[model samples]
Target: MRGFLASSIGVTCAAALALPLTLPTASHAAPSPTREAVPGSTQSLALDPLETSPGSTSTRAAGAPQEQGLTRRDVRPFSLVGVVWDDPDAQLHGNVQVRTRTTNTTRWSTWQDVETHNDDAPDLDTPERAAGGLHGATAPLWVGDSDGVEVRVKAEEPEAERAARPATLPKGLRLELVDPGEEPPQGSRAEGADTGVIPALDKKQTEDELIQARGGKSAAAGSRPFIGPRPRIITRKGWGANEKLRERKLGYTKTVKAAFIHHSASGNNYRCSQAPSVIRSIYRYHVKSSGWRDIGYNFLVDKCGNIYEGRAGGVAKPVMGAHTLGFNTNSTGIAVLGTFGSSKPRAAAVKAIARLTAWKLGLYGANPRGSTYLKSGGSNLYRKGKNVRLKVISGHRDGFATECPGRRLYNKLGSARSSSAHLQGR
Candidate 1:
């Protein structure tokens, strides 16, 4: 029944659904040109020619003008904010940060850095495969629950470095403010409604009935770790994913060998009930704006310990996703929603990651905490085609020099590993 429930969500129509038809129009416009769910109230302000300067600026060149890059001020009530820019050539050389004020408060926050080491584009060096829908971006930052905000991007390369560059600033800047909804949408996706739950024994009983359905293979293979029971996953349809915006045709690679973990980098200010709509907004941002074939992560986990399917292709299949950069091939990406730079990860979210990796990684008979060799497709950490032995369930930062999965979340990987291993009966 778990597998049936998971696959049942994918039984969508042949063509993609139109935007307005599926979207729930609340206070804001559809965040994406495609469908959007009324998960929360969010407003994305585009950077244009402004008459006044942004509230403040830092990390900029000495004596630099305030009009160096994009700026937005006096925004609506929001707890989280993210910056998006258009730089297809990756020529943008600068840092982007947002400062915000809490509701009914006069003080504003210090500018926090957004993660930018995300170059999830497929390596172009290999002639056999070329990247698709590549978009330049920086990870979103969490500013806690807030109301008013200001955003600025200082595009100042070192004076020495600017002398040899064409342009210092990234073009087309936009600030996205996300406010967690006070209540779940009346008709939100049913599957996501069951948040903070461990599936009933019927799910396990279903697993027993379908043992052969998952491919009967022993856990012993070349020193492989024991596999665990498949965890119940909320499907794209269950999360209200509009398939029309993404690639309809299925794409696949071979068997999964490793799993790389990531934080959605969107902030921790969201309610688990809003996860579906948040995911829909991300889907729109990725496909329509970011120019990616689909959402980057193969899977996404909510704070309530709910696991949602991400990317196209079957969840059980080795779907090729534009995640983990150089390690896209032979690996799967699992992203936990919300920022974790300073915030502590929820125990439920950690347990969900453990249950997920235990089953997904175990399919290949690999230990959750063990190391596995994956040839570097391309990464800043290793050269192309280098056979690097990475943790079977590795953090995104481990593969690339990124502050992804945040420092706080990264620190919790040991617990996640041990829990996953335990779930796998290690």
Candidate 2:
């Protein structure tokens, strides 16, 4: 079964770590829709199970079920795509890909792969998790500005003898089409009436934080790393977010002890002009369709190297986010806005990451190049309740059994950390 909404005003709407995390104070913001959300469309594609009946064309040998499951769906013009199957945590051992029509003419894009193993998520007991929302899902795929779309999911078979196919593919599959609206004119937020996400603090407040951080008096402890000066981050309001679709309150942990890195997994075909729309699309998808309180990452970086505030919590506070399963506690999740699996991460994107981390991590006195400890909440690699020590600036793959931040992008983490440390005066 599947659900779709087109250019409509409304719609619907991971991971764990042990070691009870203490939350800190929170601040919230409000924003109006930048443009009406792009019209929506929904699709459900039927997949052929592997090892067909005798005389049937099969992608796999007769007894191989792993190669059996496959599915795809086609939908009208939309900016973003998200896939949801029947179970939360149900693993689909396979590949997912999409190709789009770049022009009404015959021009078609080569197939693009969506990150399949996106298990990096917040702990189960969290509010978003308790809502019984997305247990398992593929990362959202962003195709360059396109009008037509299609997707395919194939079940993967492991080489090891011990690995076996589940009795069946996930029972239900749904595809969501999102139209992130047009880019707002530059400096739209300067108007008093601008409705994007509100800044967590006014200039006066931010100035005070800057003063405290520079003097190393914000959080004083021998073991505590010094907070670097706060970098300029575009607030949720700056991005023109719609506050109504999500629960408009802030959620926070006592302090951000770690910074988990991620790629939006939404493809690299977007223009900087389309960033706010991309964010809005992800925002609505995360809140309405995916059943989460808000966007999961604490901050988002664009390929153009622009930084946007993600989630509603004040940018200055320790807002808890639903990113990096088993390690969200005491951490901030920073997601770059496009897929990086097969492509190299943009240098601007990498620099934006370094600047953002240097400032945000500095607030808590964490060294971007150092390490932090977090317990596991049962990921593909970590058993529940296991104690894990991770780097202050780590990729999503370090904690979960998934290939996130992509190979090309993940390779750049070393540079990102070094740059961040340099920015923080480390």
Candidate 3:
């Protein structure tokens, strides 16, 4: 029964494949000419000048002088032709005859036979055979003779690869390899190494170094770390013409215990180049328009797999942001940068989310094993009435009626939970 089912499916797929090629279109009625042949003794021919159809008139004079037995006057009616054969050892044999005429003079005819031999030829190589030959294989080709002179043709590599290779290092950057045990001379610092090391750096400098180091580690681990834009400290005194918006007080909360995950609902079309602008826009929209003090999410993940800090981190208390319904007081909401209900989040986003969640969970000292204050049984989590225990990584919809996270992304909550568990060594 299984074999019968498999055969039926295979036959259905085969029929689907055959349907497209068999279907006819208006363009199919008049097939475009690909190649053309002209009467000539020349070793090479240019088909672009040839007429598209027979009986097409040429603008050149009929009494033009002939070169290599080829002229507009003596040229035969050219037509597009395709040569096909069952075996690779197939020859293309044809003859071109030129006839000369003058007023009140006897017409003279001359013939030139172009015969291609169906045998192994060194120069006449096809791309498929040449490609195979690159990996230690020989390609056979059928050679042709034009006017008793052997004509050779061969395929060459694509133009892109033929271009010169660029230097490895950037213009100003030079790299040198050092031996395993090699060290700089005594009391001598390396060229690019920093000598004056401060015991402690300012808050901004410390944050910058930490972010840079984390970015380096993330690159090495094939993951991404959250790196926010340069901290633009807002003063208590408002700045600029939009003084009313700036004067608006930013909201605050007691503490953040958990985080809510959400999809942007709009597709993953946010440009990575404009990430900083997008972050600022989100903040303005949340604060000015949504009547919230700051961006709703604590962090945002972009499609190119970059994680950005949404809410500032060093505040003494958690700032209130709208992400979850009942759990907003304890949850530090994180909204990923795509419409997840329609599209599956990329692997990088998943990894970044895992790392960020693990870090946040550690900071809050939240226990994954402990019963989650948020309820878990719903279409958003499992299904209604399922009665699952609250895991550390729970969906926004797991606790409330709102579809804070989309269906496709909500499914990955389990994976996030597992990643958190693994990171926590639970």
Candidate 4:
């Protein structure tokens, strides 16, 4: 479904090693409403002149459904139009229309009415209308079967437009049709529920945090090549150490263009220190067991924020790492440790990620500020099904059908960008 909402831009990176990671803290709130809540009480009864008549008591059937209220007609199919802003509370008030072909007769049903308002609540405003033309000031949509219905939504207005009207939304807002029988959109949290903002980490802060968290000092010198001879064929250990390094016998060439982020998709309770061994097992499974050439990522980060050289990064040439899509030829992959959705990442881990990405972007000469770095067609940075805009840093879901980076880690993208911006300033 295509819907627009006023939103801000941000960044996301990958983490694939093992370690305890904590993301920047956020406030929590109740889940937003997917649709409007059902009303509990009926409207005040209007005294009918006929009901007060002497014999009217006999005419009023006690057990029958009330005809005085609205009634549902035959079901029809419809599509969603744009959602429009109605109030200051951020409560979304919008309309949806269904097109139907009943007995080969075509008809249009439009749902336009007001619902409750919420600036940052968890529930979406309920639909005021339905396919049967049943109308109410506010009515909850039936959650059971919406087989022939579609949905659309819009983003908030621009700053300039918002400044002028304060309460009005922009015109010609874009709407995306959500398919029937799908879950509704979620709402933002209420204010003051979470106080911490995800901020960018600078180089010094990153280094300091990593050092403290890992209980290890940084390499005193610049990066150097492995001292041993290049392997003719990568054994399981070789693949774990340098998965992307080509075997001269295999005739593989290095051509990385983009990086893809991913999560281990395992439970988050595992310790980060165990990641190396786990990665080694993964390599064995992929190569020795599955018969692939090497491991997947070019680099991996543990929960303690230590960066491990992987695949292409271990060699001088661009080694093909299974990171991103068509853009992998010019990319460097970095995977963080731990799942994000259920657990948060450590501040140290986020810092290390910023440092690494900053170094890599500078090496590639790619503008972190350019629109090209933002989400584009086929970018895999967010969830697999959603087309979330990507920053220079992206999540595993941004490109492929995998949940590589967990939500806790993915949530720090904005802070990563902020850190990148700070470096550019320096």
Pick the lDDT winner: 2
The 0-to-1 C-alpha lDDT of every candidate, in the order given, reads 0.64, 0.66, 0.37, 0.35
- Work out the TM-score per prediction: 0.72, 0.78, 0.39, 0.38
By summed lDDT, the worst window of 10 consecutive residues in model 2 runs over 10-19
Off by over 4 Å in 3: 1-252, 313-317, 368-370, 374-389
Arranged by TM-score with the best first, the candidates are 2, 1, 3, 4
lDDT of 2 by residue, 136-163 (tens): 6677877655666656656655556325
- What would the per-residue lDDT of candidate 1 be over residues 171-265, giving only the tens digit for each residue? 66667676543433344444331331223223234234234334443333343335566666776656666666665544455557788888887
Number of the top-ranking candidate, with TM-score as the measure? 2
Q: How accurate is candidate 4 locally (lDDT)?
A: 0.35
| Candidate 2 Cα errors over 4 Å, as ranges | 1-74, 103-106, 161-167, 189-225
Clashing pairs in 1: 16-244, 133-291, 267-338, 267-339
What lDDT tens digits, residue by residue, belong to model 4 across residues 3-73? 00011111111110001132212212212222232111111111111222364433234421111111223
Locate the minimum summed-lDDT window of 10 residues in model 4. 1-10
| Clash number for each model | 4, 34, 1, 60
